[model samples]
Target: MTTDILIEHRRDIADLKQRIKNRRLQVLGLFGTPIVLAVVLLVWAGLKISFWLHSDTPSAINNILGGVVAFLVLSVIVQLVAEFSEDFDVWRDRKTSVRELNLQLSLAEERHILEARRRTPPSMDRQASYKERLPGEIARLRYESQHYRRVHLLMQWLLFVSSSAISAVTAWYDPPQPAKGVLIGLGFTVTVITAAAGYFKPRERAFNLQQTADSIEQHATALELGIAPYNAMEEASNLELFATTVEGLRADQRMREQQLDQPQQGQQHVI
Candidate 1:
């Protein structure tokens, strides 16, 4: 009965990991195409705007205005897309968190089973079976968590670079008169600040991934010592630590959601 429960729990964890992996891939696919298109459009617009700004022809002003309008339209569209993508990422992360919580619950259950089985010394074959399988399960979870963290970090960096590029381009092509230039520079400064803030935002997934890795390392060490993990004093200590870490992550996630819900005061209209 205990073995069956353990197997079922392992399967549940495996399924959740697979779902998260697939969701990350889907997000990458959906946003990747649009980002590439946006970059291409931006580059084309930049070249055209540069040409128009440099020309001495009478129509240069009109051409420059048209290019600016086109760039603004495209920028707005890209910004909207980015907002949508961020919303999707939040939803996906919530789903991943729920799955992670479920996995942890399963691990707790498995620990209970191991505790029960430890009282009755198993045969060599049975002991060998667990020795072979437990490490693999722990390793797989660590790998999945690490991959998710990497993808998340990559997404943040991409947003930072893209937003900074957009702000720079806006400032370069539409250089304002002395008085207006100051206002434009201030606006650009705000955008740059926001982008930089995003890069430094607290990342719950990274924290959770690190906790998961630590848990796996503790489990592996316990297993190597021929210890029935759940019955080991150190193993129990590590599991409690893992639980505390996960709770901390959940609290941080709640705080972030609350911050997102609150409206910012005194921001100028971008349009």
Candidate 2:
């Protein structure tokens, strides 16, 4: 664990933790999408009823149709978004079977590795060397992790602002019918986007990927520091152990990924 390696490890873990929190918030925000839309629809329904009670048949009918049209369009958008979002979750898994081969790296040796790495030239490419050799599975996992983290907040805000606009349109303002229709359409679009978020499960997937990545990093560090079984072993033996451990982690990650294809229970949330 040279200074560069330790620094890279800290950066990676910190990024993962922060991303996990953001993704979770996005998930919650997504679950809130439909709930918000439904509330808006209910309010519209009440408005329509009130109009009918006052003998305003045409206005009442138009209001009801506007709400219905918005709801349907929103549903379509939700499905489309959900379909794409599925590809973005960073699923991961782990295996305990490989524990037998792991060298129980001690704190002292770990410190020495960091000190040695720090003493090395600042230009050393330790992080690159490890990542350059990354297998396809790990590469895919990395892509998903980054993709979800970047998109989560964007999606959350998109839904929030879009839905809020619909709630803002009201009898109090007496917005023109055309303006009302557009607002309703916007509501539907945002609702669908939010609903799709609920369907895709990005938060769970990102978490799994982060966990698997962490495991790989820890094991690789153990080997780098010559700790435990990796410590006493020949270079050739250590490489073999390292290879098998990474493969095991990948296998577990793949297994966890299979669940994304399964049907998920419908969820509703309120902001």
Candidate 3:
């Protein structure tokens, strides 16, 4: 019964979130149209004024007056369309609906949290949690890997650009004192960045981390589908094998990280 209720609460939360998102879009459209229209009108007015100022034609003033009248007529038509398109009662009740949705969503979330906490002790399913967490772990590792890769590339490009600038400053032309100082600053920056990059080894870290994440994800997928080694085993044995394989992969990754953390000579000794 508690599980069923929790399921219902989960469904309700999802539905509420979707509904809230749709309402936000609707509100954006409702307000955005007027904002866009106003901007367009301002631009039109500015253009009309500019043209009138430069024009020698006597009919220019009359044309401006006609444009103003047209604008007023358009405004009225737009307002009337807006009024007719939506029910006044619905508009008035929108705030109430928003409040109710927020309250219900909050209540549902609270109930879900309470139920989850109550059930957590009795349902201490480590294997279930581990399986559930694999995808998230994979995602996090991939994201971190990509982040480190970007930083590595950025630092490399900065180093190259700074070195090139230093060369150009010294070889191409004799720059002023301020310019020379700036060039010297760039050289310092390059040196510092190079040292940091060498120390961090972002590229190698990214590669190793991504490789580990991919291996883990692949093994998890194979385990789930019962392919190859997993296929030959019973369910319990398959799960044990999967856990052992994943842990072994994780241990290898940790060893790689430890190696990366050490100095070059230390790393060589370890290897």
The parts of candidate 1 lying over 4 Å away from their true place are 1-128, 175-203, 226-271
Order candidates by lDDT, high to low: 3, 2, 1
Q: What pairs collide in candidate 3?
A: none
TM per candidate: 0.30, 0.44, 0.54
lDDT of 3 by residue, 1-271 (tens): 7668778889989998877776665566556656766776676567668775576535665577557667666765564454455544333224435667778789989989998888763322555557778898889889989999999999999999998999888876688887789888998999999999999999999999899999999988888888977796466667667777888988999999999999999999999
lDDT digits (tens) for residues 1-271 of candidate 2: 4556667656655555554555454454455666766776676678668766666657656777687768756864664465345564332211111222122223334554666666764322443354447655466777788787666667788878877777776634578887788687977889788777776767667878878877887777787788976775456666666777787888887766666645553221110
Model 2: lowest-lDDT 10 consecutive positions? 92-101
> Considering only N, C-alpha and C atoms within 3 Å, which residue pairs clash in candidate 1?
none
**Candidate 1 lDDT (Cα, whole model)?**
0.56
Listed per model in order, the count of residue pairs whose N, CA or C atoms clash below 3 Å is 0, 9, 0
For candidate 2, the TM-score is 0.44
Candidate closest to the true structure, highest lDDT: 3
